[model samples]
Target chain A: MDERLLEILEDIQPEVDFETCTTLIDDHYLDSLSIISLVAELEEEFDITIPTVEIIPDNFNSAEKMWEMITRLSEED
Target chain B: MFSIVTYFSVEALLLLLVTALLYACLPQKLRRWVLLLASYIFFYSISGKLLAYLLFSTLSVHHIGLWLADVQNECAAQTKGLARDERKALNAVYQKKQRKIMGFACFIHIGLLVLLKYTPFFSENINTLLKLAGSSFKLQIPKYLIPIGISFYTLQAVAYLFDVYRKKIPADRNLMRLALFMSFFPQLMEGPICRYSDTAVALYDAPKMRYDNFVLGSQRILFGLMKKLVIADRLNLLIQNVYAEPNKYDGFIIALSAVGYTFQLYADFSGTMDLVIGAAQMFGITLPENFKRPFFSATISEFWKRWHITLGTWFKDYIFFPVSMSKPMKKLTTQARKKLGNHYGPLIAGAVSLFCVWICNGLWHGAGWNYIFFGMYHFALILGGNIAEPVVIKITQKLHINRASFPYRCIQIARTFILVCFGELFFRAEGLKSGIKMFCKIFTDFTFASLKSGSLFKCGMDRQDYIIIIVSAILLFVIGILQEKGIQIRNSIAKKNIAVQFAVYYALILFIIIFGAYGAGYVPLDPIYAGF
Candidate 1:
């Protein structure tokens, strides 16, 4: 819902486009290593430390999914 | 000769039965010792006097490591809370002691390795030098039979010393456990190259066997057998014939043989890794994964990460990173960037690491010139990739091409295959000159007509055999694709009903029995990585 989050999603869409990338897992766009790198980048940019378990495929599937997960993690903190 | 008989078919069966019995009946503390004894027996059976050499090298390293650890502990205690001058003096003493110990360990292990593996090469060079010096003496290089797994164990021993030096893990105090870890029968001959920190705990504190571990490990063994007997051995025929006479074949045929060798190497090496790791798993021990669908890797660096992972990681940790991160290389890169630009820093570092990794890889494979060129070939490709990364990104941006798109990925995959094929051509070549000749002939005499005329089949394979090879390769690729897509094949099988499980097991065993390239008339091919 936030414009800043939307901008981040747009930036990642090309590399992590699950809708168009059938070669990847159905829900998650990035592989294990890619997800780790993405999380590091996001933490630096968004100023939030994503919990280790929250980095799994189920929660970080799409832009909307990642936003929901991040919002919850931040709220919990 | 007696040892040879112990390794024969019936003996192997008996050994397996005995091992199973021991696993069932032996007390927890005694099982490891029994396994260690059995491992030595297996080695002695094959290696004879060479077994003594292995034992000597293992024991020497074990004692030296223990001694070094004690010295380091003493130095650390003396230096604690000391003034800067006193601390510096203590640290210098510690460094000197560490260096002396490490140097002796390295000399003994590397000296043994060079003597066993490179004596012939060294002897020839020495003779040539003698002749140049006008010596009247004519010396012949004596043939020495290398002990089985000498190279593997030597590398493991060296890694153990390095680990101790770094204080990553304390030097293992138990000599038997150290010996067992180094010479564990199943992995000793051809290793995934076990590290002290990674496999030490498992070898020392083996957990009680669970039903799940047994079932999964069994499945892994079956898969390994399928890959080895059904695919690699079959491909060996074609590779050997083509490489034996590279002059006879055109580039296309040579290229095909190279591709065949790649598949054969992967199947043979990874298959054995599965068998070794799986065997360890049966004792509820988890070994480091050796392969992760290597061919699916999009980049050369990625391929190294996925293929023979332990070996790659070893070289990276012990060789490449150290060389690349050395003060001299770092200063050179920093100076170059300040003078020239940041673009060249990565380029220089990449080149250094690639060169180190490749040369080591080639030498690790063998002392052969072909192996060296194989290493150089990959070094060039990986270095080229690193250099072109920025340019590629720039070009794609300018062209408005989505680089991560499926079509783009396909192109990268195809390019990777071509790169791999070229490397294998050199790797499978009989010698360096043959590799060059075969590579040159590929461009000059390439023709599609050879395929039509059945020249491909002329390489000691029947039409039926070729058909089987193709089918099995397709099956392998299918399984690889499924795995790449994150399908857990073993878990999927586990979730299936019991009838299906039994059916799958039976099918695998039956296929191996009938279609496997072993038994009557078939020469048993040694595991490919065993020589290394």
Candidate 2:
């Protein structure tokens, strides 16, 4: 799950080092379109639905935050 | 009401000088009110009785903002000791009240915009429908006296309300600061819509004026004027002649106008931004920029990201994200993903949100069918791009072509440029039917003679005029290329000796005075986006 999150991050925006990166949206490394594509890719790979509300910067600003959200949501499912 | 066309008009120049002097003389704490007063005075000069609209926006946002904040505070206070589920219930109740306040405020602002700007268009369409149905009743189309900068101000107001509701920033307690954000005179004409969080601090801080800012601002204004006077205004003559009777012209002429209009629009809008941004800079405000040499974009999506950058950001924050996250959209995503594979699933929601965005974007420009078509056209291109991404990547990898190669990048830029030109053609055309006809003529009315027969020369410009335009355009293109490479030309030039600086300024001034298509018979176009 951790590797997958980093994979999506670096694949979409190569400059972002998910380990060190925070404020992805603030810096515009993850623009709205990139978010859309990321959501699609994540939903497919993890087989967990990431809805629009879950797409906010708080969840996706870092690989750790993203992993946390995905794990929690996976448990809910 | 002072149309920005009068950047050199005596009254405007005098007003600006007076405002600057007043700002400089005022004490630190009192300077904000000076700006607020200056904004209202400027608004009064242009909008007259319509100054009431600015006051109304200020008052409503001010009242509703406080109301939202109060509810939030009260909810927090009342729910502090409650059990978990009870606290959740209390928070939900507070959320509903906050939503109501936001909704009411949005309704008044958006309703005013729709009633003033769109009623006539909707009335005219309804009357057409009535006539088709053989009904004798026909509604009268209203001739609305739309306040200057209403669209821009309304959007700013909307952004502020959304931000407050989302708790992105605490709702501003000060009414005058909120008012100043909405009516900042420089941006009122055509906006790089200033969000409260983005610009309000700079505006209220009343930073001490620095000579560097003034010089840089003046240089930016000079570049802006050069673009407007030398290129956009000059091209206006040829565009008017070609578009007035487009069918009379051939394919090459229409194609030329398409390309010309694109250049003309960039020069006009970016010129306006430079002028306004420079004006803000003089006050040490550092307003956000609206353009970023969008022609260099390698994709339509990227072009939008660069062009009218604030509007794109505003929509993304206010419309696109909210819509994508709404319950119905989430459901649509799930269903689409299940039915069509995961690849296409999330795009379903994004597309639906983008659809709403483009439609609003089109309608926001004006109550015109062509503008609406322009919006949908872009929406189509962007959505098309999204769907084609994987296939493109696959093909590129299979062919072993470097996606980041220079030649490949140029091809993409050219392709996006042509697509944008076609979109701009519709945007600028007189009507939907005309835009369609003009587009059709591009394919049907072939003319190799337009290139060789010297017909292009006779349109509305002589040889000297064309030469001046070409030279100025080349200069702008070079600047654009350098800027794209992250070169700071203005800062670089500012480092040079006083003699070099004066020489550069003097040359631009001379070029503008000698060859600019204005001053005698030329009609200064109202800044194009001002109508919106």
Candidate 3:
């Protein structure tokens, strides 16, 4: 799951080093448009529904946070 | 009723003074109530008997907020010990029910807005259709007494309800706090449409106004007045002339009106925001900023992001994000990715969402065809920019051109400014047909004769007015540059000696008094966005 998450991040926004980067939203490395596209990509890859309420910065601000959210949601399934 | 800007009347100033004194003297717990009282007074001044609209909006949203919160709480309690899948199903049912509650509330509030604001426009269009069809019956267009700031406050109320539904902030149970949020006087006329979570705490806290808050707020208000009176109102005469009788002049004058109206709009709207935010600061009630230096934007999308920052964000949160992430758009994104490939696929959803936003943007400005065209104009520009992004990058790379060079960046800004000005032309035109005709004439009747003929001065202003406008505009531009660099002019000045600070403050007042376009012959134009 972690490896696949890294691949998704790389495919969506290749310029950023998702491994170490922590300020995806604050630094505007991920804009609102990019966030939408990223969410769509994540939903397709993981086969899990990510609702709008879960789209806040805390969940997607960094690769680590993204992994945590995915792990929790995948656990629910 | 007080004319705040018409003459910088003493009555309004006295009201502000008295309100400040009342707020300062009141107990901390009651200070928020003082603000609520002041809001009612201000609303009553403009709306008189029509204050019911505001009250109605407040009550409806408040009730809806409580209902949504209660439903969520009940469902949570019921599902706490249930089986996992069963709980999920139960939660889904409650969620659907809550959505209905939120949706119906939004529909009612927004429906009232549409009825009051757009009925005349709809009636007029229907009458035109009847005439075209050779019908004897024609619709009687009924005019409405639209309460001041309905457009702004309605959006604020709607946002508050949504915030409650989303559990962004628990449904604010205090009716008065919610009412104050809906009718905060400073932003009632125009807004940076604030959110409940961001502003409610400070608003309800009602902290005593610090010295810095008062001084900074006054300075900001004065700065806004200077922009409005010294530049925007001064230029209003010539622009009004060109727009009122667009076909009478040549292309140069029409084009000049377009550019002038654009600056006038920026100065007027941003000035109002400065004054609004500044006034709020005086009460230690923070409001969001509505603009950045939009002219510096290199692309249309960038321009929207910078200009009217709050409105754009509101639309993004309420319209764009929801539409883009909707189930249907997800399917569209999937299909587009499979057929059109990754590079252009996601933007299909983005574009459709953007299209809805622009349509709303156009209609939100007013119930006018030209405004719709203005919205579509930007939509086309932004979508075009998006689609051409990679191609432009490839071209720049192939040419080995330095895209970040000063000259190259200037070219981008200038192109974007021109595109913005052309849209504002349509936005400020008398009607859609007038805008189209004026646009056509700009190319066909392009001639240097208007400049040489000395017909420019004949529009309204003399050479002296022109000189004042140019110098003031230069000053504003320099200040904008400093601000863009993140320099706080007020703070820097505050660091100066008392004498220097006093002199600077007095000088700003004197400059505004002498140069402001309000006197025996001149009537200072109202802030343009105030109507919206």
What is the C-alpha lDDT profile of model 2 across A1-77, one tens digit per residue?
A: 48877886676667667788777777766766567667666776786766444667888777788889888767533
Instruction: Tell me each candidate's TM-score.
Output: 0.84, 0.91, 0.96
Of the two candidates 1 and 2, the one with more favorable TM-score, higher being better, is 2
Which is the leading candidate under TM-score? 3
Question: What TM-score does chain B of candidate 1 reach?
Answer: 0.94
Cα deviation of B381, candidate 3, in Å: 0.8
Q: In candidate 3, what are the lDDT values of residues A25-70, reduced to their tens digit?
A: 8887887667777888788888777876678888888999998888
Sorted on lDDT, best first, the list reads 3, 2, 1
In terms of lDDT, which candidate is stronger, 2 or 3? 3
Candidate 1 residue-wise lDDT, B290-315, digit = tens? 89988877788788889889888788
> Mind sharing the TM-score for model 2?
0.91
Q: Per-residue alpha-carbon lDDT of model 2 for B1-532, expressed as tens digits?
A: 4543444455656677788888888887887888888888777877788989889988998888888889989988999888866876787799899888888888899999999999999999999999999999999988989898999999999888877777777889888788889988888878988889878888988887788898898889888888888888888888987878887888888998899899999988899889889988988998888998898899998999899999998888788988886667666765675576545667888898999999999999999999999999999999999899879999999999999999999999999999999999999998999999999989988778966878778888667777887888899889999998899998988899999989988988898788778888776655788888
lDDT of 3 at B12: 51
Best by lDDT: 3
Cα lDDT tens digits, model 3, B277-381, are 888889998898888889888888889988999999899888888899998888788677657655587888999999999999999999999999999999999
Model 3 pairs whose backbones collide:
none
In model 1 chain B, the worst 10-residue window by lDDT is: B1-10
Which pairs clash in model 1? Answer: B3-B45, B251-B442
Considering lDDT, which of the candidate structures 1 and 2 is the better prediction for this target?
2
